[model samples]
Target chain A: MRSFLSSRWGKLAIGVVLVGFAAMLPLLNIHIPGVLPGPTYTPGALSVLAYAMLIAALALSYHLIFGVAGMLSFGHAMFFAAGAYGLGILLNLLAPSGMPPEAVFLVAIVLTLVVALVLGNLVGALALRVTGISFAMVTLAFAQAANVMIRRNTGDLTGGEEGVRLEASLVPEALVGVVNTRNLYWLALGILVLVYLACVWIERSRLGHVVAAARENELRVTVLGLRPYTVRLFVFGAAAVLAAVAGIGFMLLQSSATPRISTADFTLTLLVIVVLGGVGYRWGAIVGGIVYTILDQRLAELASSSWIAELPPVLHIPLSEPLFILGMLFVLVVMFAPGGIVGISHRLTKGRGGKKDAAEPAVLQDLEA
Target chain B: MSTVLLLLITGVGLGALYFLVASGLSLIYGLMGVLNFAHGSFLTLSGFLGWEVGRRVGDGTWLGLVVGMLVGLVAGALVAAITELVFIRRLYNRHIEQVLVTVGLGLASVALFEGIWGSDPIQISVPGWLRETTEILGSHIPNDRWLLIGAAVVVLALIVLFLQRTSYGLVIRAGVENRTMVTALGIDVRRAFTIVFAIGGAAAGLGGVLASVYFGTVSAHQGTSLLIYAFIVTVIGGLGSLSGAAIASVLVAVIQQFANYYWGIGDLAIVLALAVVVLVRPTGLMGKVKH
Candidate 1:
């Protein structure tokens, strides 16, 4: 069974089953008391799931840069924001241009993609010049600059502190109102699948091999006459574009693009998601994103619950802050479970006499190197 | 001309604050290779606690302010040292994990602070004289600017002295140059790591109180906002270089002031300057370390 599961057809069969199950989730009447706010068929549950899928998509993109390519970036949120705010502002701008709604929507998305592509290339080109912590700092500085611009509402385009809302008139009927939430959920699911497949393709491609090898030993890659810089830049750009795609989904689902999306904190959250899912595993990003979103939402509810408020101040204060809990969880994961959820699961399987894979925790390997 | 003077002095004053935070960050990164994300949390916590103590002692008085500054300094050092000992020590030799730990601490601590202090910026009373402006060469410079500048200069001098004159400083210098060589010399370098964290925390703590004076209030987020600029300064000055941090702090702050006044693009200008410096000379202006 294990050998068959490791085979290509078995993996494909599992993938089909999982995707089909996820697609049928909204039609199911399942109710998870602590996890989902309502039954799966309800708009609330669907919206929450949609948001999770969108975040999962974003995390997958981040996984490409940090997990796959071993580039730790603190500015990834800027690309996501570009896609969200870009599509938002463009829709608002082009709404009154006398074009059909479909044409306007298509043009806005294309423009957003172009903007994200340009931004990705520009930032990647400049930031890739340096390596390690300096690279992280450079990305951070640029992101901060972008955040400042978004907050300052340069040219009054970003709507500043209030953020930009999607022009309902410009959006297609299938993705606009609360009644169309299931459609949006389907859209989000589609995006997650698309992003996941893209990540898989990228990871399988020759470029992915070169990038991974460079992460392990840049000197060795250099010796082989490969410029690690160009390949790294390419992966970075690809990740940025993918992040933008997730951002577009986010804007559509939420119907608004806020300055909050552009923050360094948001990028940090993505980093946490990537690490939590198990840094080097693509599936880890997806799992981490889903788990984090649900936990974040549930924790907020738990914080405001009557039982929590009745507790002592010490317990009350810590529990009331979801981020605080998540942050501590992230720290614990880094310290105790370096491979994150995937690592722990792998260990459990190995202990159960499952097929032993030779892969160690990538983060641990990074440390040993 | 008077305006230029005001901007220059004020810019220098702000730079002094950056140096306070960046100095510790530079040393810690230089010697330990940890970026110390929690450095800002140290500042924030110290600022809150120092303000808490100072108000109980006496608010709106010079003595109160002085006492607060000292409290902030001690608080910063204590928390930083504890962080290095407890969280950082366990992750020893694992640079990425150490950074992740700090990042987690930074996020968690900020949230906890918001819970305890409330998210709003709390106004703190300063001495009456500190609220007044002093005339300097026909320009009315805020008196607090002088205090900030004075405190930062003393900090820079003291740190320089410590690094050059102390045995621990010698170990740190050697460690920054090459940790393996330092370890090979049979020196217990872990103690030096704790010392660097402590020193960095102290400066950030002092900067915290002064930052309150500069901004007229302390918010849960003040440290984080300031830390970003400090990071830019640390990078432009070249990480691990005290002198580099000092020079870059002033240069970045002055440019920020000038750009903000002239074109309302202070933050963008600083980022641009950082980019130019990084691209042109990745080692930074005064960076001697290869990293």
Candidate 2:
């Protein structure tokens, strides 16, 4: 534990500081003037914060698979949704009305993780048989298929197009006074910290090195006598669990699970977050999630306003607020900052020591050279 | 049995449409190793163009097709050129970057279409001659379906002939086999890429025309919905192999039609069926890459 803290204490310290800041955000919101005069302590903002953290967690999971394992899964959302619905089903069946909302939420997270493990095994088993673009396509196919199935078949439990709503009992009474949003935000922050620590721990573990090596060259790992497939499957499962936990956080915040959870928009947004934050770099997902959520919320507000809608026909581009901005950002990032925000930060901080930043520089050099 | 036959016919028609769209995607992927995610957007845009042309040209089906194809060709060239200059030029060797930039372009195209066309789904009527249904083997099939199938066959034959008989096709094939070798031999590979990209775009545009006629509706979201299936078809048939993509298109279409017919659940079963196939055959049936 001492060695772990000393080696990467910077990341852990940052995580603590971020969580502390997040905890204070709700308190700060109360003091801010002219924000919105409803509740001095709003649950909605907390819910949004929770959802953002959940997204960050999912993005981080994708980073592990894409960055460390070198597996570009277009369908990782499959696991995420599955894990969420898995919890949704359990809560609906078991808790019904007796269990507290917080307990139900906790139970859901566990159930989701288990479901992810099973799904990870199945998908990984099949995906490991392939490499490169083929693997990506296969994963995408599975995710798309799963999305369709979930949206169609389990309508009764999932609430179909209407979405499954949480019973009032599912929310903790303790949270009722605090405003459900604040409770959720705190909960999300707690989960995010735990998950981030887990990811960091995994990154520093021996298995993590094996996974990274497998990403570098599967054949070389195979020659080294390690079962690259097993390493990939384990990491994929772990990543799925992380994503599922995030999904649970999302459900708690939204108080429901809709077919929109599986929409192309959601998948695309997640991809944007991952790319915007930088694919593999540590803390990239968290940074990306914050930027994306803030932009999205602000853009929606701007688009809905009367002044923007009243603009001249030729000069006005409708729905050009968030999506256009995001699209342009994506293009610019791919063209210039291929490493993403976190990647750029790493480079800046590394300065002369950046020679140790191995694989990414080599990949970028290949692009530039 | 009648239902089965009906499904089969309908499947073949849809498959033909998918073939028109996916052929370009497969070709582009083969030569350039870049998946043109915006292919579906091109199709949707062309469909809208066809609708506009039909409305303006007093309901002439041939004129609509001509205008749609012309617009598609121009749009295709523009998109290909822009993508080449902006994204593809930077991501020549990086597969992930290629995927990311194309996806970004796809999103931008979708947003642009939404901005122009609004968020609603627009219905595009078929021409008078193509509106009637014909009875074949005790099953009623739409005339437009038959026309689309015929068009697909013609397109397929033309593509085969062009690839087999033409010098440019030979060069493309050679380039696909080995880009470095072709470039080393002094062929302007960039020019070849531009042509390939344009051709791919044209195919997508033509597909839009067919889709508008068949679905009777066009929407900004249509491109994304169709893209997944097209990607699946290309992957299942083997990426970069025209024959494989064509065959896979038919297979996917037939399966989807049957699933929709018998299962009656929706598009999900068809997607699941495709996933099953992928799980079993990661490299697809005709993929050159060994899994």
Candidate 3:
């Protein structure tokens, strides 16, 4: 049984089952109190689920850069904004150019991907010049610049602080409106699966090994005639492009893109999600994304609940703030729970064997090098 | 020509604000190698409390403003020192974890601030003199610009004096150069870390008060927005050098002001400048570390 579970066919079968189960969730009447607002089949729950999946996909891409490449980037949200805004603007711009709605949708996706690709390369090429903290800082500067540009609404492109909405005329019919929430949910799921598979393929490839090695020790990789810079740049760009893909899904699911998506705080929240889930594990990101979304939503509800409203100021204030709770949870996780949720689970289920695999992400310390 | 004069002085005034925040960042990163994301929270908290105390003391009076500045300074130092002692000290030698802790603190503190003060920017009352304009070279510059510049100059002088004159400053300078060597000398370096945190926090706090005066409002997110520019300045100035920060602050702010005035690309210009600097000299203009 153990061998079967580890076999390629077995793993593929498990993945199929998991995806099938998730896909059927919106069609079922299952309820998870405190986590879901209503039954699973409801539009509200489906919307939340879809949002979580997109976030998970984004976090997975971040894992490729941070977990796999050991790059501490505080600016990953720019590419996300790029994907979201890119699609939003492209759809609105092209909708009036005598293109059919279907054609416009297809063309807009392609253009947004293209824009994201170019942006990823441009940012990677420049930011890759410096290593470690400087790299992080440079990326941050670029993201901040992008944020300012969006907020300024120059030429009336970004809609300033108001942000741009998804052009309803341009999007496909099946992906629009509350009644079609399940379609959007499936789209987000597809994106998550696609991003996850891409991340797996990259990790299992020779380039991934090289990138991982460079993370471990750059000098050793350099001694092997490998250009760690090029490899890292490729990973960074790929991650950025993937983040953009998630952004597109995000735009579709929400039916609008906001300036808030472009902010540094958004990127920090992504960081929080990744760390909360687990640093190096792929499933961790997915789980972290879903869990964080649910907690965030539910906590907001809980804050406004009647019983909690009666609490004293000290208890009431901290409990009422979702981000404060999440942030404190994150700090505690970093300090005590090194491997995050995945690590804890591994330790609980597998005992001695899991202990070795569950060690704290050594990449965290190596970031200084 | 008058426009040029106005932009130049205004740029310097803005640069002074940037320097106030960047100076401590430089010192802390130089000595401790930790990028304190919570530094912005310190500024935000101090800004709120400073305004609170200032209003209660004498609202719109110079006396209130002075008291507010003092409260900001103490609040900053105390909060920073406590953070170092409680959270950062526990994660010694773990740079990434230290940073993550700060990130978490930054997020939590901002939320807490919002909880306390609400999310909106509170209009602050300042002395009437601050609202007036001074004519310099036929250019009308806001009176607050002089206050900002003067306060920043005094801060820079005091920090320089402290670094050069005090024994702790001597240790801090040496520690920045080679922390291991200082540790090998049997000196207690953790104390230095706390001191640096306090000093950095104090500067940021002072900046928070001045920032309220400049913007005429205090908001939970004000520190965060300004923190980004300060981060830019800190990087351009070469992470650990005081003089580098001072020079880069003025240079970046002036360039930003000019670009904003001429082409409306101030933030982009600053970003481009950072990119150019990193490409040309990755260590920064006066950066000591070879990154």
Task: Give the best candidate by TM-score.
Answer: 1
Say which candidate scores most in DockQ.
3
The DockQ-based CAPRI class assigned to model 2 is medium
Query: Better model by TM-score, 1 or 2?
Result: 1
**What lDDT tens digits, residue by residue, belong to model 1 across residues B1-291?**
999999999999999999999999999999988888998999999999889999889998988999999999999999999999989999887887888889999999999999999999999999988889999899999899899999999999998899899888889889999998999989999999999999999999999989998999998999999999999999999989999999999999999999999999999999999999988999898887754
For B148-192, candidate 3 gives per-residue lDDT tens digits of 999999999999998999999999999999999999999999899
Q: Give per-residue lDDT, candidate 3, residue A34.
A: 82
Rate residue A107 of model 3 by lDDT. 94
Off by over 4 Å in 1: A363-369
lDDT of 2: 0.74
lDDT of 1 at B117: 96
Q: Model 3, residue A344: what's the lDDT?
A: 84
State the TM-score for model 2: 0.91
TM-scores of the candidates are 0.99, 0.91, 0.98
Clashing pairs in 3: none
Residue B128, candidate 2: alpha-carbon lDDT: 77
In terms of lDDT, the poorest run of 10 residues in model 1 chain A is: A360-369
Model 1 residue pairs with clashes: none
lDDT of each: 0.92, 0.74, 0.91
Candidate 2, residues A76-162, lDDT tens digits: the string is 887677766776677777675566667766776676677788888888788667767767767777777677766665546776677
- Mind giving the per-residue lDDT tens digits that candidate 2 earns over B165-283? 98788878887777778889988777777778777777777777778778777888877888888888998898888999889999989988877777675466655655666777766
lDDT (10s digit) by residue, model 3, range A1-369: 656765789889999999999999987999989889899999999999999999999999999998899888888999999999999999989988897889899999999998998999899999988888788899899988899899999679999988999998778889889999999999999999999999999999999999999998999999999999999999999999999999999999887788899888998998888889988888888889889988999999999998888999999988899999999999999999878888788778566443346677778774765
